[model samples]
Target: MATIFKTDAGNYKALVRKSGWPTTTKTFRTSRDAKDWARRIEDEMVRGVYIQRSGAERMTLEMALKRYLTEISPTKKPTTQRAEATKAQQLISHLGKYSMAALSAELIASYRDKRLASVTSRGKTTSNNTVRLELALLSHLFTVAIQEWGLGLSFNPVLNIRKPSAGQGRDRRLSAEEERCLLKAVNDHSNPMLGWIVRIALETGMRSSEITSLRRHQVDMKKRVARLSDTKNDSARTVPLSKWATETFEAALNNPIRPIDCDLVFFGEPGKDGKRRAYNFNKTWGVLKKKLGMADLRFHDLRHEAVSRLVEGGLSDQEVSAISGHKSMQMLKRYTHLRAEDLVGKLDMLTREH
Candidate 1:
């Protein structure tokens, strides 16, 4: 039985047939629309096509997380699944008792205010961006559940939330003097690999992961090439080695640690595994740059420096892309920031044309 009523706000409503789940109700802008909704509800019940609505609408955030962990998280990769678990934990711990269906613009706004005001595990004040990322992560999980898991959620309240913009990208590069200083000052005690890492990074524009994971067998000293097997984006590329890079290979090979590990190129520590010892290089890099008062520089900027040099060496976009493994010209353009001073000869051609 369907009972029709008019709301105090003048919206028409209908109480559709009570099913096994909570009594299904339909609200409509018009009486005819309400009647149509009631008819559809009854038809779904009769046909046995109506699945039970998620108890999530009636349950807390914690309840949803427990369900996801036991029922779904097992199917994902370990790292990815762990990240999802962490996101769920954050939500459960913070908004544990909050019902998903009851989430509104104002409630989310209040949550953002609380998260931003709270201190993080790092004991630092939480920024708007941090809060925004957490909220966005939660929003994405809801989307995944509704779309991927067939949760049948009709509304996503997160759609109303605003995201904070990631601030300006760091434009860091080693100046000529700073580069010389870094090369000259590096020693075994103070990041012996930094000078070599810096140079190879500048020469090849290979990602840090690719360079750190390079093996002795992958290098062809005579051919001056290193074959990287399936790097980021599952890309297999051969980086042409410069003369300095070839010599660096020889030096590493001559060292007693080279071939004993079979294919491991850069060992983490003397006896440790090469694969496990892959360096992030930030700590040593920070100290070295601080010594020279160039603390603003980042180690990854070496790749940018390498690309800049490649552009200056008169390599076209295609040529540079092949060596550096850049997928598109637009990506390469970001690193090709040449100053007017560096374009002296090119500007002379413009004067001649004028």
Candidate 2:
């Protein structure tokens, strides 16, 4: 049974008390509304499908995102943590005022459409992949709220919405003349670390984060292997160093000006907090590329160039993935863009052998 009575403030209040269930109360502007709400609650209770939505109604998206950043983001990798924090800000700015209960699939779909239509700070339209990743973060937060945080959400709104397509992978390969100019410019820069980092990427096909976050002890010159324990995929791998790569490592290791307190292979200047972090050469790299007339060439393309070279050198697909730390053959194939000029040499050799 339920009680619907007029309140002292000229509003109607509905109260429901049932056996084997917690008491629930809600204030409504009209007596009819109060009775209607009470009847729904009673019907749901009888059907054994009642769920208290008070918590979801009170908790806003802003509050949930902050909690997630504090409790969940720290458990991810440093790169992932940073990326999630940025994505959280974007979500918070747009949909933070909406309570969890108020966020419907239609509302989330509107956000998706708006984000796809908006331009980024970089003066380009936001990519579909960027929107997809943002939605993915939102979806995960809702899942965590339901399963772990006990927020009592009936279903994830984000799951009900369509995600943007994952755009095509970049097939940007460096040309020979461009590579020569890039190397010369980096080698001649005031900061020698920039040159060594570029050479290492070209030689070992290591990710920028992997190459920059290296410690001296991780590299073994005698074994000619650079051991990576904190990789992007959370799988440890040992990258075999080429003769050229070994020489570059030796030079960087034996740098006379290197601070004794810094253990990072590529150490930057001390920060305001007096911490010597990894070398941040993004600004420098950007300037160098612009000067060399290769403004479109990205640093990751260097890794692609190296992987393609490995494949062209007669290394098997498995062999290339092992070196590049790629988890799947499909992903490895995306990076291996073989040049037509290189294939012509193979064709000529086949004719001679026959």
Candidate 3:
């Protein structure tokens, strides 16, 4: 039932009371408007489609993102948590003042466009993947708010919005010439560990983080296997070492310059506090890339190169996925691209057999 009253301020106030639902009240200039609002609200309640959006209307996107970071981000892996926190900060800077109730698909689309057009300090436009990741974070935030936090959002605005295409996954594999150039550059660098790291990544398909964070105890020289206790997927797996990788590890273990404080296989000299930290090769890698004229090459591409080699070696997808630590076969396929020239040999072999 709805009750309409003439308030002292000469406004018509309408109130709708239902047994199972919260009471909804609104003020309008005319009784017709008040009645219409009451009728629409009651009808929605009866159809079980009405969501109480008071909390969403009260809380801004900034507050919700902050709360999510504190409550949920810690549960994720450290690398993932850092990236999510950075995205959350970007969203807060753009849409922070907007209430959850005020966020619409139009607004989210507009934000997407804005981010796509924005350039970084390096003068490069933000990649489509970056925009897509931002939307994913925003979508998850709405989901948590609606399902767990009870923020009263009816739907995720990001769901209704179109996301920028992530574009094709990078299929950039190093040429033999490029590999020779890179190896020479790295070997001539000041740090001896840089060449070793590059070799391990190319041979074992290990991520840079995994190689850098490897502990001495995790290496089994007898078995020629390295045990990874903490991986990106949060699952433990063993990576077989190549003959070269095993030899490098053996030499590194026997190196007199190895740090004693840190258990990490690749660590820097002790600071004033006498604590050794994981070696950071960002500056060194950059300088080497410039020197080799391979500025576009990324360290992660080594993993791609390794996976592609495994695929070209006639390994099944399942076998390659095990070495690459890819949880999904689809993801493993993305990294296992074979060059057209390499495939030519297989095609010729098939023709000869025929």
Candidate 4:
């Protein structure tokens, strides 16, 4: 309900009231002007029309971000937390100062354009991949903000914004000789543990993250299986531990670092806080690859080698899929390459049998 009042002091004024929102009042120079503006605004409200909200409000971008940050504190996965936090920081930098209701279709389009125009990591224009990643994070956050939090049910403007294409999956792989060379090099290195990491990568087609997060209790020598939970897809899986893998576990049991707590099988060097932490040897790996003139091969290529070898060993697609814990044949197919030599070998074997 609203009321129009005329003041003898020489000003015409009006008052507006709405449920769940504060009342607003304005003063106008003439009674005619006040009536016209009041009627127009009231009529729009009666018709359920949206008026763009501005200023620091409950649904402002900054408030939503603070809510998001406060909610993710219970998680302990450092890598996952770091990545998500970095993404949130990017969103705050991009849209934190704006009112949630004011993010219209046209303005979102403009923001997308500005983000895609140039990538400035350290104030210099960089690659398209950087922009693509940041935009993906933006879209994901807005999706959560609108759909999950119900910040503005009627006003999700991100859908109209076009997304840039994310490129193909990585295809870097190691041939048989290269795998042999890598194994030999790792074995001869000053770090004895490097060889174990390399061997485990070849034995289990697990990602580097999964391998690094391995715990002693996860390994079962009796059943010859390793239990892994919280993998890439957040799915739990049990994979076989080969004879050599079992022996590796036995070797680890002999060396105990700081009375093992919980299920941690492997721990990194102590941090400044004096707590043993799990570390990634990516830099050392990079240096080793560079020395061998095989720096082009990525750590993930080790998983590819494991898959390729399983195929070469005459394991059926299903057999390899079970060990690799791949949910779909599509993901498995990317690592499987057709070898002309394999076909030639089959032909030669046929001739010999005949």
Best by lDDT: 2
lDDT of 4 by residue, 252-340 (tens): 55554436563455557777987765556888899999988996888888888788778888999998988887879988888776566
Please give the lDDT score at residue 19 for candidate 1. 53
Q: Per-residue lDDT for 71 in model 4?
A: 66
Question: Candidate 2: lDDT over CA atoms?
Answer: 0.93
Clashing pairs in 2: none
lDDT of every predicted structure (CA atoms): 0.72, 0.93, 0.89, 0.71
Clash-forming residue pairs, model 4 = 268-277
What TM-score would candidate 3 get against the native? Answer: 0.90
Stretches of candidate 4 off by over 4 Å are 3-15, 18-63, 72-77, 109-133, 147-150, 256-263, 311-321, 334-354
| lDDT for each residue of candidate 1 in 1-354, tens digit (9 for 90 to 100) | 678899988998888666564477756799999888777777777787764344446666677677777777787655556777776776777787887666676787778777767897879877766666678767875776677665556667778876655554445766788777777866444545656666688778877878888777888888899999847656788889888887776766566644465565655653444344554576777876788887767766878888888888898889888888878787777766665577998999899999
Tens-digit lDDT track of model 3 for 1-354: 889999999999999999999887778999999999889888999999988777898899999999989998989988899999999989999999999999999999999999999999999999999999999999999999999999778888899988898688889899999999888877777787898888888889999999998899999999999999889898889998889989988876776787556688889767799788778898889877887788988999999999999899898988888888899987887888899998898899999999
Report the error of model 3 at residue 42, Å: 3.2
Q: For model 3, where is the 10-residue window of minimal lDDT? A: 253-262
TM-score, one value per model = 0.69, 0.94, 0.90, 0.75
Model 4: how far is 334 from its true place, Å? Answer: 4.1
Residue 338, model 2: Cα distance from true site in angstroms: 2.1
Between candidates 3 and 4, name the one with more favorable TM-score.
Answer: 3
